[model samples]
Target: MRQNNHMLFRINLARRKFLRQGFSLLASAGIIGCGDSATTSATTPVVIPPDTDSNDTPGTLTTTSTPQQVVIIGAGISGLIAGYELQRAGHSVTILEARERVGGRVHTLVSPFTNGQFAEAGASRIPSTHNLTLAYAQHFSLALDPFYPSTNNYFYLQDNSVSLIDAEQHINQPPWPGAVNRSNFYKIRGGMANLPLALSNALAEHINYSSPVELIQQTNDQVTVITGQDQQFIADRVLCTVPLPVLTKISFSPPLSEEKHLASNGGYDYTNSTRLYSQFSQRFWHADNLNGWGDSNWPEEIWQPTWDNGESSGIIQSYLRDVAATELDTMDVEQQIANVHSRWQHVFPELDSYLLTNHIHSWQQEVWTGSAYASPTNLQDSALSAYIGLVEGRIHFAGEHASNFHGWIQGAIASGIRAANEIHNAN
Candidate 1:
């Protein structure tokens, strides 16, 4: 059950560094947005019958045994990759998804906006260091583009004071607040969600959407998965890829390890990451040579999601976590908009004048994904992290929560592959 940043903020009081991180901390610090709107065009999911008659190559592994029947829970990047690779390697894979769409936390949202402009509702940036994510993009032939703005200056609001950080200085700094060297970051050209779509397509007719797993039970030789609707799937191996929060909903027979129970049963701390995206009639800040992105003492990362798009209209997003995010969650949609408008104006004074429409994408709100990425709430959580991804008999686990890269899609991809290999090589 989920949808999903790790950009660190430049917390230094120095003027140039104030917005230097520019919503940097949210993603870098492991805070990320989750639960994209289901209406995104790129995320339209198709349900297909599970693979019954499996495929196989005339290889040693195939000749020795029958193809493994794999049940992969959650069609996120990790789950999809596991399913795709398993099916490709001649295993029968069935992916159970809670939502009608794929790409749990990595989605591209395009709606209620004009002029072919779009915004990222979930994971956006893919750093060069994320070889797995990059390699997949290349595998799918998806184009890449710089994630940061390349024009004018970055904005920051401190003590109700608006200031512009030099664009050159901003770009010269590293990716996060206090990183070693300047690194490059990129996003999929069309949208971030396309990566998952490609994976989903590759596993066509094997993905079951709107089929949430309610229970997972296993015997010595096989595992049985029961969906919320009473549908059942039996597999030689079951890979659970849901976030810790969502994972709590699925009952497990014989119970999971104490560590897994600790991590999923509210023992883990997840960020309440929220993004407020507002579209304007024109690129108003460009007149002042500002990219309409920065940070505020209000403890938020302001981003113009479509800053690079050569469109007449533009959109800006505000990334918030914890206290700031929880505060907005209490209000109605309109109130949330008003609350953001009142505060965001201090950074971009001419905001309300050019505003056309706005929407809030809060990760905690989606039923499938209850919170953002997992971070150790305390020492117990830190200790519990290692056990989160441990394999159970006839069952395995994978997700951003199970990986060191917690908040990024790369984490999910890596963990999925790890679990897939574990099952693939198992006797």
Candidate 2:
């Protein structure tokens, strides 16, 4: 979640200094400002409704199906919230998700070690500006924990040389030129997935998971969704929340409007590709007195070692940048581990003593989602406006990409609310 080179450089440098001092920067300059004051009672935890029971096979396309009150495609945050709001508006809503589970890109991975540690494979943090995400936490009694990225770090260059940087001073300064913008990134207290989990809990009855819509055809009147599993759902109003790249591939009976098509095509360029964060049960970085920041312009060299929930423990978690994507599938487990170890040797000379289990999440490999949410490029404004714009007839599009905030849980929620408002006003 970094942008603009100068900002990134400054933030990373400052982060290194802060971590080396164990968050002492917050005390000196009020950086993060006296820890989070937000807390919620454990007894009133957010409630997620029970799972659904329906299944649809892919081959049976039904044309005779009439329009439902409302239908949403994709159950990611946008889809989830859209359904939630629509149902709240008293319309019969159906959410068709291509994946088997909910939460879209917000994945909170529970570890097998059972030591109370978890890692997020997708969409991990929410900045203080993420109003929607924070609001839900407050409404559901979820606690807010501070995720301080301003700490010590290791830098890897193309020559494979490593440089240790102090986060405190580095963040306030510039790493290269544009690094200052990187300071806003933050992680959620419970987990990145908790926000979506909270929303899903609020809208359990209306969603249908594992239902990928293969075809979206609209006549003069209503839209019909044909699933890969052959089941069908018809609705008067349809909200498409699928990724832009995927949306371009799906066939729309008479074809979408020129603006919608252009938006879908143009939006792909903004998509942010990501390498999943690997989770281990131990905090190896703490043992070696390191802040788990190992970065390189080359993807393979930028393996980062991070701590789990525990501030102390010898088990360190690490994840390589997208560089590993090219060779990930071809390499064996032993080779992959060895490659990661090689990179760590540069940033963390003492890493060998505290290393534990290793896990990797390659978002590109996920069939449900090809990559992370879209990143805003120069083309962002027009493309986002196009995708978020109402079709004027009966179609609406909502998702993380459709949001102005873009690429976080809050964007999804905000877009969902926006789409709901659009539908409500049309009636």
Candidate 3:
């Protein structure tokens, strides 16, 4: 009977893996098809002319004789990529970033942890189906590793914990329905920030860090971008790549259309999310022969960030969203850390003595970001998605929120390429 149960677990795992991969393939193709707002425009179709140079790569744009001056807001992936592609096409580009650092939500932290262990505070994993993201990673020559290579996972519910491998016997049933089993998730080696760092390094001279955009004024022939520091930049075109929540802070000349304004204000759903990373002096979870990935009703989910890093010390991360995030937000940093530690201990008593240090990153409290990423409230609202990416006069919009692959790095890259292509074709 025991042998039969083990065989059943293996069979179920294989079946789940197959189904997950099939669904992922379909979803990727669907997102790619629906992600291009320029082609799916409701009003006038955006016509992207074929490359005049046959040798030009798909992502690279052809150089133009008359270069147009372009100003990009927010030095995130979308803005940086837009600036890089535009400059490569022989256009003068200037990028204005509100924060001292770039990479928007793709932040990686190394300090406060020992033994070369690191953790991602935001935007941790990349799905294999994200071709554009993969292309950029390949371009940068960044190494990739499985996000959760181990098949073993833990579930803590209602004050009880069980390994997924023994879940059937413990719970007298199979694992929870709709549980993801595929190993398609990946993270960049060194850190996820390496992605934006590569793009930033390529456009070092063009990026103006700590320059926050205040307002934008566009005319028939030119557009003017004003910074909070009272500096003004004039360009032939401007791309607004700031997050929707942050975008609301910037004023536009003549104001945006009512629909667009509303969309930027709150039409999209930006989840209140928080991430906590805790490093331990010893690999307590691994010593128990259990993968340090877990989920619970209390804190949404938790995973081991240093699982594939071959580090003796371990880093476990917890993600809290919605109400859990709100509840934690009310507490002080120390209180929040204690709360997470206590809750993690409740799930795994072994973690109590091994924890050495902890760090917290609250996206809800992040000034420029406000929230993690935007999600469509109404799934059928294709126009809502398409409208955000539409070119508004000489001003353009590009971000993860504007793409169908919302919340992923791929969305940002695709949006940036689309915006750059729009400017290049116009030239």
**Candidate number with greatest TM-score:** 1
Would you list the C-alpha lDDT of every candidate in the order shown? 0.73, 0.56, 0.72
TM-score of 3: 0.82
What lDDT tens digits, residue by residue, belong to model 2 across residues 7-90? 224222232332333223212322111011112212222222221322111111122223248888888877776676566556
> If both were scored by lDDT, which would come out higher, candidate 1 or candidate 2?
1
State residue 377's C-alpha deviation in candidate 2, in Å: 5.1
**Candidate 2, after superposition: displacement of residue 221 in Å?**
3.3
Q: Residues 1-427, candidate 3, lDDT per residue (tens digit)?
A: 2322332233222323433443353245333220011111223221222223332323577778889999999988889888888998899999999999989988888887889898887888865556567556655656565455333345564444543543223223322354222344567767899989988998999999899998999989999999989999999999999888878889999798766787777877777888888888877765454666667768467777766555677888888888898898999999998888777776567776787888888887888998888876775255476677888899988888867767788778777877887887774
Q: Which stretches of candidate 3 lie over 4 Å from their true place?
A: 1-58, 151-153, 156-158, 166-181, 379-383
Query: Candidate 3 local accuracy as lDDT?
Result: 0.72
TM-score of each: 0.83, 0.72, 0.82
Error of 2 at 30 (Å): 34
